[model samples]
Target: MKNSRFSEAQIMSILKQAEGGAPVSELCREHGMSSASFYKWRAKYGGMDASLISEMKDLAE
Candidate 1:
């Protein structure tokens, strides 16, 4: 799989911003990412936090 330019933590932060009422288009513009990428991250990591991400990575290893 191709690596993402944004880290998981950064992705989570972006998603949090969305949840906090930021417009999707504005976020995409500010972060230089596509809306598709934001939605994809939401699908994969929507409700997760940093610890969960780290745990998932440890399990993957």
Candidate 2:
């Protein structure tokens, strides 16, 4: 699979920014990602912490 420019940790942090009351448009603009991409990430990674992401990676490996 192709890897994204931002890592899972980075994605989580970006999502956190949105949860912290940052506007989705500004977050996307700052991160150079589209609003659609942000929504996709939120759908996939929402409510998940970095440790859970690492665990999922370990399982995939």
Candidate 3:
């Protein structure tokens, strides 16, 4: 598996910001991440919390 620049928790928090009505473009800009990466993370980790992400990672491993 490839290592991500941002941790799962950070990804989840960024997703939460999007969920809470933050604009994706602005979030991406502020976070210095590309829109592609943000959407990719959202697609994979959209509704997942940190613990759930850890569980999924464990299962994948």
Best by TM-score: 1
Model 1: colliding residue pairs: none
User: Cα lDDT of model 2 overall?
Assistant: 0.93
- What candidate 3 gets wrong by more than 4 Å, as runs, is none
Q: Per model, how many backbone clashes are there?
A: 0, 0, 0
- Over 1-61, each residue of candidate 3 has an lDDT whose tens digit, in order, gives 6878998878988999999999999999999999999999989998888788889989988
TM-score of each: 0.93, 0.92, 0.91
For model 2, residues 1-61, the per-residue Cα lDDT tens digits are 8879899989999999999999999999899999999999999999999898999889989
The segments of candidate 1 whose C-alpha lies over 4 angstroms from its true place after superposition are none
Name the lDDT value of residue 43 in candidate 1.
Answer: 95
Question: In model 1, how many backbone clashes occur?
Answer: 0
- Ranked by TM-score, the better of candidates 1 and 2 is 1
Of the candidates numbered 2 and 3, which has the greater lDDT value?
2
Q: Model 3 scores what on Cα lDDT?
A: 0.91
